[model samples]
Target chain A: MSDSDGRRGATRRGFIKGALAAGAGAASAGAAGAEAGDPAITELQPWMRAFGPGVDASPYGLPSEHESHVRRRYVEWLRPDTISAVNFTPIHQLDGIITPNGLCFERHHSGVALIDPGRHRLMINGLVDTPLVFTMEDLKRFPRENRIYFLECAANSGMEWRGPQLNGCQFTHGMIHNLMYTGIPLRHVLDEAGLKPGAKWLLAESADAAAMTRSIPLEKALDDCLLAFAMNGEALRPEQGYPLRLVVPGWEGNMWIKWLRRIEVGDRPWHQREETSKYTDLLGDGRTRRFTFEMDAKSVITSPSPQAPITHGPGPTIITGIAWSGRGTIARVDVTLDGGVNWHTARLSGPSFDKSLHRFYFEFDWDGRPMLLQSRAIDSTGYVQPTKDALRAVRGVSSGYHNNGIQTWAIDSEGRAENVEIS
Target chain B: MSRFRDLAALSLGVILAASAAFAQQGGKLGLGRPASPDELAAWDIDVRPDGLGLPEGRGDVLTGEELYTGLCAACHGDFGEGTGRLPALAGGEGTLTDEFPVKTVGSFWPYLSTVWDYVHRTMPYGNSQSLSDDEVYALTAYILYLNDLVDEDFVLTRENLPAIRLPNEGGFIPDDRAGTELPAFSAEPCMENCKDRVEITARAGALDVTPEAEER
Candidate 1:
């Protein structure tokens, strides 16, 4: 290859694979590859040369430039407007847990709200003995709590029911994000409002143009609902809620209204449209499943998933993924290679708490043969994830929401992983 | 960079000196004395749950319907069916077990207090409460009627607002996780040989993940 000749092209798969194996950020891989195996060339491009000065950086960072294409892939086959409905995370390309806040997938019925926190206020009225309005500053004066939790849209894996509808974890599971939040306990505000003796349920409403609202059971409200003001550590990013969001703990993400403005206490629930026509799951019969509040235990393998294939095979491969249970802590996660026939307990690699994402890993040797991979999670309450067949038997396939079925990715002899319907 | 740092340090020193200088200048910093009672009143409008901050005024259902039709109906729907993709504010009670549960104010909401508070703080879609306190009360009553929670004769005066009960009012319970659910896993310890090392028995494509789409 001559320097002036366009005859040589940048190395493709090998360059990518080698970069990943060498544990280098994707951006540095191009130069690193040119210097690899050559001491003199390595000397020419010192490691520090790969980075710019500190001031040249950003307070918040993004994925490596080489990964510019690693974004939500939309299905042109699905809609007229790209933003209206489409795109997913590159789950296969991501490592560890904690989806970067920006890269987390988004599905909005209405556009993101640009709310001004100064003009924000939360009102507690209705059947309450006392009605109160708390400004943003007033809310900050209350006792606060911090929690790490994952919010999964009811439709997180809904498309998969039809088959391996989408490849990559981003499309399948990017609908979820985990983060630590700072907020006042929902119970404190309810108490301050002086709940009436008969008050039993509450309605949470957003100030967004959508006026998104939902009725919540009093038990769930008082139990873990959080009036969250901070996400991660800083103020909530506008898209996530801005000044305030109702943290319904382990419940569906939609019910956690963002830009929260009101709470009405009452004796019973008000079945808003959000709880009915939308989030509700339809059955095979002419019926629907309503108020399906609790998110059962679930787990998904992130790496070696559809997007990330087995670039290096047949060796000491470390399989990692996230497992969580809305009901409680994940008691155990079992990895099975021969379908469900053979099972081995995987190691919980990172923190595993109630209602929070738990990272798990399993190390194994692949014999360069085609392998079937699956992970099963069991919650503290002895609730084990059901097989696809088991879940469909109960919920039926007529519904497009709440599809928490077991997920499987098939690997062929070529080492490429593809979404597959094993059921 | 050095010059900038020096400037910052000088500004800090100036602020420190200014604080002491103000004290020497006596009670008022020339900005005026501590805020007066009237000044405090001008900025204070926090409404308490016990009816602490309600402004002087009142509204009824007829007036509320007119205001709602003018300001709210465009997005919330003329009858609260809700605008496209937006939530339907009416219908759906006792439908929790159904596949398509329709939770509306009449059918599912637990309290009337939320209606009043929400309207006062944020409502009328984009404009948000161009109405006064009396207008907010009337609009709340009108919405209650559309949800079938109230008749046309119903009124939502502050005095009667707290007395109104919602259907799902008693449906909530606190999240008492301690004695109710899982046993405390927080304990002394167990780290050593609990398990030596983990081994993988499976991969992703080999087993079932999603259910059969055509089966249902």
Candidate 2:
């Protein structure tokens, strides 16, 4: 329905009555016989009459018990073992663009490495004027920068490459997190050591047992890379590389090595296992695409999704979600209520950081009809998010990464939603 | 207080202060000490596509098969078929275009350095960085044999590794989405009446692939 539909003739009392009449079993429990305001306001409540615990109850505060459900969840089949496993951040349960450090999605190759800051070291060797090793204290002595960027694993939405399969937005797109990284510009450190004349490539290596590695072009390393030591105003979590991590802005997450220990300057790219056998994108004609970095602009409706179904019987509702791009900031987002039949411009809000998540919302009064909802994002580079069919047309369904297609969620008459693809 | 003891202490303090000043004057910001040659060797295991870092090593196919049976057969399979959800090292030669593309090392990897480096750096599952250089060369040769790329009696060495090439050496190209996909996808999208009608094509609930929510 249009924005003016409900404001024309409906009164506040009338709207509430209409919603309750259509709400069915969704009404509050014992609503059939409860006296108005008796148990809550008219009577004394337990919390008002009791004393609560003081500040020292917790040395470090945690989320309230009621919010225990809001957490990182993993698909059992996706991670055969805890090692070489991943878990999705509960994006649907959050608001705003900054994902809390504790709730960020984690991808580990060899499980979490617990390192003592005093014992940890970062080494830079190969083709340099001087090879150097910095203790964690020495690293902190350098100038630092704070910038927010989204690190998305290439395999995000990989399960949906063939079709809509995952039930919620979290499972399909949870292999991503946006946060502020505090670190020294890799160029500063590289300049201090001094690159040799023939240096053209960099090999980022991790300290985990997997010893994960990826090759990066020297131009990219100097342009916007970071030897990040902190994230979101605190020391990096052990699960998130602890003392140090590499921040490759707008690149695939695998290249942003965690538990980062060494960087080798060279004249050529090192064909590591992560790059050649895994992250490469396979096409329909037996050919592959390597280094398919830079996540395209994409958006998804977090609310009114399968997990967070609308519950107010559709008088006035808020539809909100997230949009981001690796190439640039999100320029605009257009949401559709009737699938692809029409679109409405969504309002972008909160701080808009480049290469970071942007929150958006579309408020409308629902007329209580079944709907097919979808959102499309256009980035600063003028690249419009394509349909799943559009992406499949050129790349074919063989690819398991870079599936940044528009997503559709079908909402039924009873105010329930399901993951679906529209024809 | 002894005058001789005080004089000795003052002279020691002066020397300590001088060395502290000298250590802080290296490189920019005077941070991080020079890495020793031995220190670089401890962590420098990267191998380039052109065989830049291939260490001296030699191993025959028979030796590789025996080592493979002892160390890698549990997860990677005896013939590199891959047991459970672990990755396969061979076969799936022409299925890259099929609906279910079976990406194996032989059929998919573009460089021999990747196979050799992976075995050397992070193989043996839980016990990574434990294999010797010769053992890594043997395991790589065994994988080549599994992929039918090397003869059963072939011996792989550091010198010969550069000449060896995988089947899909030329199968990969750099990302071209900017050139191939950006233009078509950048047009001003339709705002109204774009579709006459919409119908549900597939549903996630119908497939039941979603893991049970309550399961930890």
Candidate 3:
């Protein structure tokens, strides 16, 4: 055998040897059936001894039972009813760039609408050469594009504006999900209808009970907007607007209307309730800032967080998290172990797609010391994620939306982590 | 007579050829059909701040109060103070600058049309779009009354609804993040000793909002 092959074989044998030694130790400590040094090589595990379930067992597969703990969770007190509620993704348990389809966070104004794809129709009218209606099949006929983007609710960390109100990263930072979306560019559909000369804004209307609507600028609609029909390479989940949804890239999640039905081109912004009353950012001076579309660059350490506290005593540890920006791609992520005293640039890994979640890591050997962990991200636009105090200095604590402040996790000597604000 | 007949036949042939070309081009993609006017109208329920799509309707405060109590009181509370986690629609008039601002329709909303449009589109929570135009108008008036914006005897019509200025009409300014924030935040962030001393100001765990960690 080649020298490389021999090295590989030795590594595999070493792993097996270590596992067997651990198994033998457990067996000897248990019932008096096995010898300590003499390992049972002839014995087989339960799966190896018996026939496994057939492929037909699960027509639709689910994650292993062991992974049941990883799920979208919501604080019951946040809303009156689940219908008009928000559920957070378990960011602490999740790894990598893409959030699993099942665990993508959900924020619905009206409960999920499970409309039949056959009955769904998308209408493009108002200030167009021809008002057109497209069925689900008709929408499929158009040329499509795939993009990976992060959808963050403007209020993702709103509760943290006043102070660090949620301990776990799952609750504080889980209101966002990164997904690979497959859909047609919204520009093509608008072009098909032939926008009139005076058209400046497009009103995207949803088919849900609330009929959620938002007036998007015509420039944005023609730029990077998408009419998504599938997510993560599968038909969208019913709760995620199965028939169709709008993907307003780099914008607030609320503007990405689900169960989208109509697009009405107009000459000016509609100044609807969402843009004016709800999503507007209220300043310290009591004046509200309207149409704050782009989500600022933000980063949060997912591991070593409240949910995924350090269990393996000390020594070599990988401090990893996700960093993203709505304005553009993440330029760099700097992690601070001693709060703002010192900072180290984290290594960016995986596909660094624009306006998408970029996984970052910092390998450190913990010397069994308490740590004040924090992450700060700078986007391609050179907009750095500000400190909590810096953000409060400008927008103040009264504001609920667009609280993209640097999050800090205080790791105690025992390795338990908690959310905290530093001054 | 023969020449005239020949000319007529030639014109008919040209018309037929042009129509055939049109048909070929029209059916090339074979995608969606042109939506009928009626079909488009059914789904177009958007109401702009300019009262562009507000249906012809009228409702007074008395009618609004009765409808609000029956349809919206359970969640919004009779006084629009909001029940439980539901949104408070009234009160909080001068609390915008307060530490805990109570942003209700009366105090925070910039446009009266938004109040009318949202209630018409999504109010009564579960049973949306069940309210008639008149009922929505009444609800809007009642909510305005609750906020103490308008007198009880005032009637809300499409013509005057847009004219009624909200209390915080001038409170909104277009986004200035690009100018005010981006420039200042764009500075090369510091690497070493950003601050002399760091102090723990607050702790979220102390509030007990997060659930207890599950046993491994």
Candidate 4:
């Protein structure tokens, strides 16, 4: 394939090598020529001659039009209809840890519900000393805190369990987003209505058409859970449960109920459909596993992937991606170039918080050789991300949830990449 | 050491007295009002496995058959076998250990209350919570009958619902991941020569699951 420079008949490896050598020769010549005579200083640019757009052109700003390609995408054949389907975050295009509010992935059981916050009421009953109902204003009166955390669907890399099933990292591992949520701690709200002696579990229910429900242990609800009202510094988007949602840190995304309307304190776990029939992981044996929450340590290289291929000839290349663990903060990430033969500890960039996405980078000079790229993450809990074979050995191929297998990107001689399974 | 222990005991006694005063103040932040019984009844629709929240209703399989054909047959075929991407509700009894298991209700579900609760909460796909109490009961009975769990003449009620046990009731085990999996996976990962040779076992491009990128 021809490169952007229209270098014909040269292989990708040859093109990169030749370009690098030519670049070095040109740089030396340009330095000597600059000492002889200055030229670029005499040129005038159009931006310096013209006035830019004034402020207030857009009261609420948006990403530049050049960034229009960055968007959530869905596979049409994955579901029967869009109402109960899922769309993936554009993780390949993102650099930092925080995913933009609008570009966050969407997974709806019965589509996004447009609830009127004015009419919405949160009811807390069942095994509480006082059954209480709070309006939006009343909810705001309670003490609140801000936290950054990642919400990962249990089925994030589920398609890869049997084998590599999606060509892009966006499809295989993009069912997650990290956000800064502003909300009141659930303990504060639950304490407002005193817990009874027998309270053991909680039923967090949504107000959408599906009325999605899941039973959470009372201890977790009283821990780091939040009744979130805002995300990423602004009111939550409608698709993100505008008025309120539950941020069950480190748990499965489905347990973080959106458009939350009621919380029932219970004496026993509610074997709802989500917990009993759907989310349960079927095993190689004839049994199933329930309440398989908490995503394990996982990582994936975002760029230089199938969707985001290497365009420029190799020089100073930055291999960057994200790593996260539901159990705790990511302790370290190791990147391998030739599959898992040799590894280099990647540099962890940006703020590292518990249960939040951590950005990592491995900067190196590329010599235009093909690579078998993979990243393995280890969390503070000392659990390392397992290989696909290692994971299959334990959980079997029947499990469609919690497939935190190490992903491999096969880079060809053309610097183009594709998803493949390695043994 | 005894003086230090006496001082610590005194401080603990004072803290207990302060907490007692706070408890007497009714744990009130004075934010939300007590919910009326009617409001609680309207939003509290969760059904436990013990049939705690089921409404008073009874429906026979014969009535369920008519209702299933009329209401559920559009997405879930006449025999509870799903059409398109809709979930299949029956006929996957012995397929759990197969290469590609069909985890339908009769085959994988561990509780019958979940079947009734799911229908009452979010069934008919689009028109959720639109079924009457009796209709939900009838649909549950029909689905059970479709899976051969119940006979055609069987009737379902809130009282006898919890007594019905699913075939896979004993198939579920609580998540032992922390105890079973954490130790095995917690070992220090090897850095060099983790494997002798790497081979491409499979390619996702060959599967053709990903959609083609649109021409920019």
Candidate 5:
């Protein structure tokens, strides 16, 4: 709808009531409910259907043919070619905390290299007392652990700092995905090298065509970091570090080098180009900040924000979205109904894990008036998601990375939500 | 003087008693048992900052260049400039200012240890660790040579590899935010009347709706 239409003689309240009365239960959910009532007609298919012949159809396994709209979206301007610097995930269309594997966004410095798992080898060298190379089978012999964490690119939701450039959440917040990872603890492998007294850091390297590498602190390595092999209970997809990747807990996703091949122990930290020139934040001054690794706590109201709009009337409205923290588990999330005025605590739902997305819901009885919506997250460490103005006040828009601005959704009297900038 | 000595001895006894109680609690949880030698041997594969885990191997730049040309040149480029869709593995020194800053091995990596560890562990496009130990050393030597970090005749053996020093060796320090910054801001935050009022400034397109207008 045009901006000028709501300003006409008939207010948005009258217009919404008329539309709802004319099209009772014709929305997306209502249509789905109307189509599938009978649940028990498929038992005869296995014996009757001819598999070798032309008579067969898929039953339990499928990506809905109609879900073509849910495919990955690429930012054409980001990279010169499609293989590298691809766009991130579309969190707007996704409904729960977990991002389905098919729709998980991808970014590859070099095009995805298909690796034969049987032939893959991970080598540990450098300052280690005894360098060792472990085959995939050897890696599996070690004890395994599982943990769910969110991997967010430093550039997630970066474009919004200048303006509300993207209309969908997939484009804005899609550069992040959460999954349960299965792998061996980094400490187990580090222990094998017999770290010397002065050793303080290690470098993880990828065997991709780009040969990506990053320096990790010794403390973090000995902590919860993992030498991940599987994601979300299955072998990682080709786009996501297929054979092996470094699972650096609570850190940036790019640092989790996919197709990992080597680790070198060292007496000091490595200031590789990835850390100093690219990942480092260049502030307002000429001086550049380095090794700024931790991704801060952030949240956004997915529904009632952009991609999903409110078409119902002023009665019981279900407002929902996602919240997460890199430092630790989320403690609380607040939903602002009237802009930033009196705030109401939203109910946080789903399994809460450290560095994992927390789903939240806020139900309100609307009275057919224009409303502004926003969400704020508080992590276990007591760090609050900063307001857009607050972030701009300190860092300014020039720094495009690590933007956790408080997103605002303005709902008109007509029940439509628009991306809005709160001064 | 006797009374003072008695009080001091009594205080010391109380402190020791408290410590014993703490130790007993820790013992119940089985927290401080040193891992068995076998247990340590089973899982300890980590390489430290020093040259600890390096295996016996050696290679020269001449052999490394051949390996690179065969396995990596397709994607990384003959000169390590990186291809159209792949990341450039060379150049990018002091160019963090350019609109499209290219960070490569020569320009940005802070630790020589990382370069060695990364290359040895994972490298080449399709085949991972398919190369022998000598091949990894050769590849490392060739890459260092390409970046002008080392001479063309440089040989990367278990002996000389640790001697190479990276440019940004002192670039990183322990995170100072918790100790140096957070404490200063930990005082009671102003909760009420700190900000008089907030005003609305912008909105997203999909969020705003108008029923009077025909659907697009």
Candidate 6:
């Protein structure tokens, strides 16, 4: 092996030997009982001794090699082709509210469309006094607004609707991301094309190969929608509609039409393919709930989840997660340690923007006993997140979309956690 | 002629009216260019449920069968039962209320416009929007025939397509979550001793369906 590789291997072996010396227990596991003079802290580390790469080596940066495992992942069984499928965000690995543009989840009807901004045009037609077409340059001329919002797929926790199915929080609750979108208000743009008297609905269409379409109410179109051109303070990523995308704040991600090409104002709702064939919540009674645009309050414990188990066992255990509400901001989050036996209010950390993700943390001493971990969010609208059975009692398990029920994870005394449905 | 004079006057008035309407609505930006008729026609792809935007086309079930088998049968079965993980386009007509609802195009879709618009806009999987207007009609007709909505010899036209009501047309209700769900979901939740007992009824690690995940 190479000299550096040999040294690194030796270092790893030394770490293992030190861990064995510390006995069959966690490695520097807790504050109360940590092994003294750990080699990692006491010994001269290679990173400290060596010179890293020059700044010019990487014009654009990526996560450290050690963090390569934190990435967007997908279930092969979900769809046959990658072109028309979904991938999940690595929510467990994230800390703050803003999801890095690279780690954001992606759902493609056809596939990501890479378009030249110079060639892209957004058209406004139908039931307007004057149909108007705006070039990308022209769209930039209009006044812009920035707002932080969470875009969640209606089927975020779809696999777990029947019961606890997907093991990780990343799989079960990762079809969502919060971002600060910079763009012109959709109302301002629609006003530029002067809406006719009876224009009640607006159709947002994409320029992707699929040309996705969804009919939104005119009231919602004017309320808080935006034709966003950038996200997280940079040019939009191609997967997030790069040149342009429509932002229907607080609605299902599908309604936020990416790669936006057209907006047609009409008198009534057009029963488009997305509205009818998909996105609708089909209940046990066979009656589906159409135009169910807004997502309700939901939360998931990112750490201590199946994917993010407690590596450092016991004492000073920090249970953290993310919570959000499409209707408003998350007011409080209640975390239960012994299932529903006792509860504690988690500290809502970070900026809690309207309709944006709110991070929460509940710190407690881990008694090193088997426990059931759960988190529930309460929104500004006073909407309390319900239990799985309470949700199923009303909506039934047949519906895949809008599964915003509480999630429960069972952690063993060893600190390993798994997905489980409790009664 | 007087007729030509009247037409010219009417066109001038329409332009004036448009400018006046914009001014009244406080559309002071005037940033975008006026979309010409040709430009509007090119991008106006959506077809409403009332058959508003359907292009004139005609196709029979026989031609649709050929297209379906050639282009779609790989993902969706020959009889529209679905293949592997792809969604089924037909059947499952009465299973929506069942324990496991088999929601297919023929069973749950409320409007035929969705079938035509979806196929023309994005369909045939990888080769989306590749079908001619007539081909989309044929495919839609074939799907209907598969679900017993139409006869084998039936030719679907833009005019007749909307009239062919899907069996689940009346099966949909607008979102009533404000009245039904919000009231139930938005309540003072029990903080402690909420349940009589807690038991692990189901476990995901046991199911082992999580893709590429291990016990952490």
* Predicted structure with the largest lDDT when compared to the true one: 4
How many clashes (backbone atoms < 3 Å, residues ≥3 apart in a chain or on different chains) does model 4 have?
A: 0
For each candidate, what's the DockQ? Answer: 0.05, 0.40, 0.36, 0.40, 0.11, 0.39
lDDT tens per residue, model 4, A135-231: 9899997667899999999889887889988888889999999999999888877888999999999999999999999999999998899999999
Which candidate should be chosen as best, given DockQ against the real structure? 4
Pull out the clashing pairs in model 4: none
Query: Total clashes, candidate 2?
Result: 0
Candidate 2 iRMSD, 1 decimal = 8.9
Report the CA-based lDDT of candidate 6 relative to the real structure: 0.87
| Cand 3, B chain, TM | 0.82
Q: Tens digits of per-residue lDDT for model 5 on B1-216?
A: 999888777776786676466444422211112344454333333332455556678889999999889888988899999987576778776664454456666765555545555565445544544577788888878888888888888888877777776554443344444563334423433333334566666544544332222121
What DockQ class does candidate 5 belong to? incorrect
Instruction: Report the CA-based lDDT of candidate 4 relative to the real structure.
Output: 0.87
Which ten residues in a row are the worst by lDDT in model 3 chain A? A4-13
Q: What's the DockQ of model 6?
A: 0.39
Which pairs of residues collide in model 3? Answer: none
List the candidate numbers ranked by DockQ, top first. Answer: 4, 2, 6, 3, 5, 1
Q: Name the runs in model 5 displaced over 4 angstroms.
A: A1-60, B1-176, B179-197, B202-216
The lowest-lDDT stretch of 10 consecutive residues in candidate 5 chain A is A38-47
Error of 1 at A376 (Å): 1.0
Q: Model 2 scores what on Cα lDDT?
A: 0.86
Better of 4 and 5 by DockQ: 4
List candidate 3 segments past 4 Å from native.
A1-44, B1-30, B214-216
Q: Please provide, for model 6 over A1-423, each residue's C-alpha lDDT reduced to its tens digit, 9 standing for 90 to 100.
A: 123433333432243343344434544433334555556667799989999898888888887775766789988888788898999999998998999999999999888999999999999999998999999999987767899999999999988889998878889999999999999888888888889999999999999988988899999988889999999999999999989999988899999999999999999888988888888988777788999999999999999887776756568999999999989999999999989888899999899899999999999999899999999999999999988888888888888999999999999876778899998
- Per-candidate total of colliding backbone pairs: 63, 0, 0, 0, 55, 0
lDDT tens per residue, model 1, A1-423: 133433234333343344345443443555566757444455566655686648647767666655555565554554444433535555655655566666556555445678888888787777764566777887886657898888888878876654566666766877787888899888777766567888888878777655677878899987888999998888887778888999998888888888888787777665554664457655544355567777767888886765566766467777777888788988888776544455778998667767988888899887777766778788887766765656666556656676666677666655666666553
lDDT (0-100) at residue A142 of candidate 4? 69
